[model samples]
Every structure is written in structure tokens, then in C-alpha cells.
Target: MPGRLQHKSALITGAGSGIGLESALLFAAEGAHVLLVDVNLAAAERAARLVAERSPGVQAAAFKADVSKEAEVKAAVDQAVALFGRLDVMFNNAGIMHPADDNALNTEERIWDLTMAVNLKGVWWGCKYAILAMRANPTDAARGLHTGGSIINTASFVAIMGAATPQLAYTASKGAVLAMTRELAMVHAREGIRLNSICPGPLKTPLLMDFLNTEEKRERRLVHLPMGRFGEAIEIAKGALFLASDDSSYMTGTDFKVDGGLTSCYVTPQGEQVLPPPASLI
Candidate 1:
């Protein structure tokens, strides 16, 4: 049988590491030609090599692009089309959680500006260009492909709930992503483009691990998680895959939360330990 995303093309941002890198691998494994975009060209290239090694014969390439810069983002999208013939999925997954991004009063202007530039404005640019490309996507009858595609933006559980350890700018920027994704989905629904935001909970990714460095800091947050542990990047990548594929054909403008039940719990239950080991691609 053919893979779920066989013959489709995908472009993933921040493909150097974390959720982005894992998604690139998963997309390629599922037979989607993938273009991994990152500001760090070497990192992206390394990820592309991993794709080739792990999923041989799958088309995977790397490009250098800073999602915060519109020109670079546009160029990356163009490169995906040039290499893969069409853009079937756009994962706007590049973002930053600045170390100094504390509460509203403590966070500096530069930190807030930088977070929004990458997390909010970057997502906007990705959506803008991806929609344009998907609009003109050529029908590939042989591959069962057609115009329109899926756009998955990475938001956070913090976008819907408050965090006591406040990364104010990071939280705010994600909230904006959810909002922007909803409006864009509405605007492009008729055109066959589907837009949705995937809201992940606190994860064990480097981005959050660096912030929750101290044991005290980590415990402070872990106590609230019903799962009694942080999430993994591959878990989020699995959610992105669903949004990218035809499995979610009827879904659009949804705030798809793969948040380990963080947004729903008041007090986590304590019981026998049987949690599955975290998934990885490295």
C-alpha cells in the first residue's frame, strides 16, 4: 500500500531540531518530498542527510531561511516548489522562547519584539506564501494531487491557559497564532486551503528544557501535568502529520491540542507508572 502522504510535498521551518526536525523525518518516511528550512544552513543540511539515511529514495532537501524575514520565507517556499513541483503541506513550526522572556514587567522590549517577529510575524509570512502557492498548485492526476493544501502553525497550551512561570511574550505570540490561523482558515476555506494551529503543551524539547533548567523549575511545572512528565517532540510531530494528511479532510480552523491533557486538568492523578517511553528520530 502507498503511504498516507505519498507523492505530496512538504516544507517545514526550523527543521534543524526539535519538533521541526522530527516532522521532517516523519513526512519523508510517509513518502512526502520534504524541504527543510532553517536559519542555520548546516543544521538543515544535517537534517536532510538524516532523512536520506533513514528514508532512502525519499526526496528531502535543505534550505537556509529565517522565517522572521519575509524575503527569506518567500524564497524557501519558492525553493520547495522548485524542488518538489508543488507545496502540499506548510508547517510553520519555527519559533523562539527567549531566556529573558519573563513576566510582562521583567521582559525587555527587545525580547518581546524578537519573540513576536519569529513566532507571530513569521507564521503570518509562512501562511501568506503557502496560500499563494497552494492556490496555484497544479493538479497531478497521476499522484491523486490537486490544488489546496494544509497549513499547520505551532501554538502552545499557554495560548489558552495562564502559566505561573510566565514567558509573557511567548504566551502572547502563540495566542496570536491561534487567532490568525482561525481567521485565515475562514478566508481560504472556499479556496480549499485548510489552516489550523497545533497547540502543544510543555515539552522536553531543548527550547523548554533550557528554560526549565533548575530542578525546582522543572518540578514546579511537572506537578501540574497529569501525565507526570513533559511531552516529546515526536508526539507533536505526529499531530502535525494528521493535520497534513487527508485523514483530517473535514477539519479546518480547529485549535488541535496535543497537550497531554494540560489544559483540562485541575489536579493531576497519581497512580502506577506505565507511561510509554518518548519517541525520537535520532
Candidate 2:
């Protein structure tokens, strides 16, 4: 059988490493022409090479763009269409957490500003241009990739459940993503373009592992997970694959939680939680 994403083109931000890279690879494997977008040109190039190698003749490419910047994001979305004839899926997955985003009182103004700039504003820029690109144009219509596509914004499990782990800026930014995705989905549902958010639980990405470098910190997070382990990037990539394809043709404005049951459990075989959720920090 032909691949699910056959003839589709997908632009994945943050594709240099972690979930983005894995998703690029998986999308290519499923027959989507992949564009690996990253602020780091070299990293995007490296990932493009890997995606190309893994899926021969799949037409993988790389582009440099800081999604937070409007011009760069516009250029990337335009270039993806110009290079591949049309864009069919857009994955907005770049995000970060700062060391100083501990709590509302302790968080610095600079940290909150930077986090929102990159995490929230960045996603808005991507979606804005992606819809512009996906809107059926005379040329795109002739090419058969008419106005309609999937927009997958990466939110987090923390967006739904309050976490004692802190990272207030990160949490707030993701909450904004979930809200924006829902609103946009409703606004565009009749227009053919579908939008949704993916809420991944604690993953074994370099970013999270580096943050939890100490065993004490890792154990604190592990205890909250019903699976008793961090999720793998590929696992979340698979979830993106399902959304990118027509398999989710009826889905939109939904929060797909690929969280290893992390957000669902109240108690487990181990206990109620090695550490209780901090009593509502008044």
C-alpha cells in the first residue's frame, strides 16, 4: 500500500533534534516531503540529511528560521511551498524552559518575556503564515494541494494539570497554545484547515534530561508518571503522524495527550505519590 502522507508536504519547526527530528523522520517515512526548520541552520541541515537518508527519494529539505520572527517564519512557509509545490501539514513544536521560571514571585520579567516571545508568539506567526500558504491559490489548486491542511501545535501535559515541578513561564506559554489552537480550529473548521494541540508528558528529550540531570530531580518527576519512566521522542512523533494524516480527518480543536497516563493517574501501585502535590501555594 502507498504511504499515508503520500504527495503531502510537511514543514516541521524545531526539527533539528528531539521530537521535531523524530517527527521529520517519521513523516518522511510515511511519504511526506519534509522541511526541517530550525534557528540553527547547521542542525536543520544535519536533520534533513538524516531524513533523506532514512527515506530515499522522499525529498527532504532544510531551512533556517527563528519562528519568533515574523519575516523568517513567512520566508520559511513560502520557501517550503516554493520548494515542494505545496505545504500540507505544519508542526509548530519549538519551545523552551528557563532555569529562572520557578514561580510567579521568583520568575524574572526577562524570562517570562523571552519564553512567551519564542513559545507563544512564535506559534502564532507559524499558524498565520501556514493558513496563508494553505489557502487555495490558483497555482496550488492546479497542483491539487488546495486550501486545507493540518496544524499541529505542541502543547504540554502541564497545560492541563498544575505541576509542582514549577517552570511557571513554560506552563503559562503552553496554556496560551492550547487556547489559541482551540480558537483557531473553531474559526477555520469550515474553511477546511484543521488545528489541534498535542500535549506530551515528560519526555526523555535532551532538554528535559539536561534539566533533570540530577537523580533527585528525575525521581521527583518519575514518581508522577504512571508509566514510571519518561516518554520517548518517537512515541510522540507517532502521535503527530496520526494527526498529520487523514486518519484524523474528523478531529480538530482537540488536545491529544500522549502522556503515558501521567495526567490521568491519582494513585498507582506504588502509592499516592512519593511527594504530594504542593498544597495550593497561596
> How do the residues 65-179 of candidate 1 rate in per-residue lDDT, one tens digit apiece?
9999999999999999999889999999999999899997899999999999999999999999999999999998898899999999999999998775879999999999999
lDDT of 2 at 241: 95
Clashing pairs in 1: none
Residue pair clashes in candidate 2: none
Identify the candidate with maximal TM-score. Answer: 1
**Where does the lowest 10-residue lDDT sum fall in candidate 1?**
273-282
lDDT of each: 0.93, 0.89
Best by lDDT: 1
Q: Across residues 1-282, which tens digit of lDDT does each residue of candidate 2 receive?
A: 678888889999999999999999999998899999999999999999999999997999999999889999999999998988788899999888776678888999999999999999999999999998878532344434566899999999999996657789999999999999999999999988999999999988888877777898888888778877788888899999999998999999999999989889864467454443224411
